[model samples]
Target: MTRAAELPGAASLVLASGVVHLDPAPAVFAAMLDGWAMQQRTRFLKASTIQSRTDLVRRFAAYTNEYPWQWRPVEVEAFIDHLRSGQRPIVVSTARGYQNTLRLFMEYVTDVRYAWPRECEEKFGRAPVQILHEWNTVAHVAEYEGDPRRRPLTYDEVQALFDAADGRVEEIRARRRKGALAAMRDAVLLKTVYAYGLRRREAWGLDLTDLRHNPKARQYGRCGAFYVRWGKSSKGSPPKRRTVLTVPEMDWIVPVLEQWLDEIRPGFGPGRLPALWVTERQSRLSRRSVNEAFEAARDAAGLPEELDLHCLRHSYVTHLIEFDYPERFVQDQVGHEYASTTALYTGVSDEYRNRLLQRSLDRHADRWSVS
Candidate 1:
């Protein structure tokens, strides 16, 4: 049987020896989407990602009140404008993602192998063409498009945040409040995130056994390194894994983790629970809980509301650079595939920049004196 014969309502298009004629344009468009989704599944894309792309296409179709075969570049522009003018306007990055999804869908439909192009041409007299163009879409201007208000906390602010986190436990305990143990866990978890330069999911997905000892950092015992099994993955790939070596600067985590394991965790009756951070129910801590913990600490510290849990990781990168760690080493430490990506996370303080300028001037003066 021919490919067209296999699709619903397309058997009429199949003639002797598997030659395909044009079918109804609308029916072919539906089959084309099904085929595209099947292709995406075969490529190992996550179900969530595929669903999101499908939703975007449906939204676009709804906006124009037309089928894929009838879409035009003008409709694409108008749809983007509608998104921008909506109650909750989409950001540039989000808009770019939507545009890319449309472009890919159009590419698939226009390809001859899919039969969408020929079907559309025979029915409507014109085939679907790519509507998204470079001039109409958002460009890749920078590696980071994060909020400008979000920045790495200074060393003093980090200390203040940690102190606030610890202080919360004492305040609750003094008041005879019930959640002191949970508060302590949150404090330690926040510190661990900063210490290890971890993303929220990375920290949330950690297991107790993921902690390992570094031979050179014997002083830290088994908490000398973090075996991150849930690092961020690229499209259609499994979670990336990396081992983050604990630096001496963040060695304070050693004692904290030891205390949590020996003293605090036992109170929850974790028993055979494998999660390093567990809820009162002995379940693994969630990403939402991590965000709440950081927010609570930020409010207690009297810090800016704009600073998020991610700023802790940003601080880790900036501090590593300030500590004179090699650029390549910093990139590897943060699991960044490119130095440019690591550079985006780095926001060194003015004081650190001034120190660099002074060193550069001193070197230039020494060369002049020698001449």
Candidate 2:
């Protein structure tokens, strides 16, 4: 009979004959490597924040190179101490993110195989996201007296945003200006966001046929449904996605896109290849560029700096809710499997009750029309 230590994926040397061996390829290193390997199996890191998370892991690994896998909590505490001695609150927060990622990795590596240390609860008592947020708050408070939000663009702010982009857009239309690669890209994406109420990933996923006035797929005005191949928690299964778009929803964005399509898209043959949005030098528009473009447009619109692409989706939902649209319809349009996902918009209890009350009053009221 073979001991579990002799398993294929196990370290080159292990707890052989009940004596722990400190092989050069340690299990601690293997665990980290395993975490990295797992990350490659999924596409969660596309958000770019994972890079920061990974960097923190690298820092932790470098700082505690000789530490054993069982000594993780101790090493983590020591790392926290080291962070406290030199860096500010923000650095401490950054360290916490590293710890959180490490914990998650450990959980993945050990799941039912090894247990997390009990002392972990005492060390950092907050949920992972809360800890990171608290750090941001402390840093913000230190920098400014209060929370200074780069608020979402209001409806009026949206107008101002377009007004600012109008000039560069004109230059693109007239062929008088080959705008900065970044700027042109930014203008087109921002225009799409406001026009389509597109989620960041949706905008990123745009292919040429997604914008067709007469799509070969013929997927227009069908409950405003647009197709999405990949989705969150889809478990790596590609579904026939149908997303919602109203005639009024993104029509304002079409002219700018038409101009881009006419000018930038591939012509008949190799030039006629498919990429709805792309670079002047390349054929594919990267997800990162779409986001960077939104950031650039927010700056060009003279809006606050951190207005993100999700805000476009948020603004869309806000509009639908404000118009008293049914949650079921909204849910269907958004392709949410659960209606609860769409219920976030229905917080106006007073408005709903008052509308019901007003309708009763109107029906009962004596209307005497006097000239």
Candidate 3:
């Protein structure tokens, strides 16, 4: 018999030999999770990812009232069904993600490299199996699985959103409310997000030093590009890095950012704080605060509830397309690895599509003319 140390997977390392428990089932389940976490840590996976995966497994176990060894395809199905039937059901993409996370956990435990199966079978009457199947899980049928309502705001809508954000600052100041400074910061923050086509974390994670001067665009000075250090990362990888250049169309943001850094930001008195956006408490602005700011602006603009802060990113992609920027340029600006991903964010207006159609027809006018 192989000692726990000799087992290939880390699972056995959590199961000390001769360490009996009052409840063997829960003990073994916890060992499986601990082993899996240790294994994932060795791969340099994010702590949040490991914690979320472990939590999902625990939730699934509780929902099914069974241990990992007792989980079956039916339990997976029922768990998802219960989630979908809830008052606030998960979206298709969210459901797919949950299923995939559960599947990955199952795979880790059942993998022979981990030795979870052999240990469970010896300890219990059964062993864990991969319960999530392709047929049972949500299929990745569409390139874009987001809500259809979540789309690019039109030029007018974008203007309205910004106007509302600006109006918020005035409203607070007029009412002599305490949050006028915060409102001003939020207005500029939203504009910065659209200007850079940044994701929420990328925007919030920005630091003062990340602003870089582009030699060719000397007029914008240090506002020429942003060194995005908190870009979305691949699994088991550190945050990706990218330089998002300030395009000519969005040059208006140059003055906006400059004013914020020089005039508005100092009001927060965030002495020695390196963050680009600081709160009243002289701390870095949080991602949740950014979301709340956008929501307030969206509501004030009378935009649909489905239109969230990400719509600004979508709008950036769409407007860039309409501006005749190359697809590759737009993709690179947004740090997308593939142009196809950029296309999913683009929701060009019908007028822009019609203009494209007109250009194509004009190019073929001689061929289209009657003989």
Candidate 4:
């Protein structure tokens, strides 16, 4: 079938013909956005993804004060330059993402099958063109583009952070505060996040049923691993799935998780709720709450402000490397698609590096000894 024939009704230009409007420019622009959204929906893209892209398209239009058909390469360059000069400038990665979004939107409108170009040409004496070319857009130069300050926490810092989380619960109980249960839950939640090297969504999306037992590691029983259902999704895809097994080094979490599941979690009255982390309202804990919990603990621990909850995952990767785990094993444990990406997360301590050096020197000692 022709691409145009395959499109849904909303994506077709049949309605644009009957529209006798005072300002056809705005009406045509709105129709084009609706058509683009309908096209994305047919591909099974997430609604939020479609909405954000359309919103960005509208913002770009407002910034240039021109419809898509009237837009030029200069407008894109000027807008990006304006973004870079502002007091709160967007990072390179964010700018690249915006440019790519606009590029895709332009491609969609200009494609022969979409008929947006023909419609615009007939109405406005021009057609939309892709303005974001390679020379003007940011290049994907490096595998890792995150802040350098966002490094993995050292073992001492990890311990201090956990101690702070625990102390917060104690302080609440001592003061006869009403949030003791919530505080304790946050403490356990943070530990679980570090233990399994989970992303925020993966940790918050956990349920009692996600807990699994490894036959080989019968000692930890059902707490031996977790099935992550909300692993980060790639473009136009559902969330990836992975099984994050508990390593021997991080097994301290077995008891921590058990205590929450068996004893402390019951205080929340989660009754029939299957969520691993529940609030007083018996609802599954939100990703925002998880972040707030980490922030409070980090502040109490007096750690650097740059260390966010994801730093716990970085710590997990770093500690696993220091504990002598294989690179492939660590990559699998963290659900990383590439060892290089895992390597980016690893900032091994100088002590660990020194130990490795010493081991190598010991192995080659005889060669350098008096011969």
lDDT winner between candidates 1 and 3: 3
Q: What TM-score, computed on C-alpha atoms, does each candidate reach?
A: 0.88, 0.62, 0.95, 0.96
The digit string of per-residue lDDT tens for model 2 on 136-197 reads 22232332231235333567777766666665666666785655444555666676665555
Better of 2 and 3 by lDDT: 3
Best first by lDDT, ranked: 4, 3, 1, 2
Q: Which of the two, 1 or 3, has more TM-score? A: 3
- Select the stronger candidate by TM-score from 2 and 4: 4
Expressed as tens digits, the lDDT of each residue in 180-272 for candidate 4 is 999999999999999899999999999999999999899999998999999988878899999999899999999999999889999999999
Q: Give the per-residue lDDT of model 3 (tens digit) for 289-320.
A: 99999999999999999998889999999999
Candidate 1: which pairs clash? none
What's the CA RMSD of model 3 in angstroms?
2.0
Q: In model 4, which runs have C-alpha deviations exceeding 4 angstroms?
A: 1-3, 8-16
lDDT for each candidate structure: 0.87, 0.53, 0.90, 0.91
The best candidate in terms of TM-score: 4
lDDT of 1 by residue, 92-170 (tens): 8888999999999998777666566776777678888889889988899877776789999999999999999999999
Which is the winner by TM-score between candidate 2 and candidate 3?
3
Q: What TM value does model 2 have?
A: 0.62
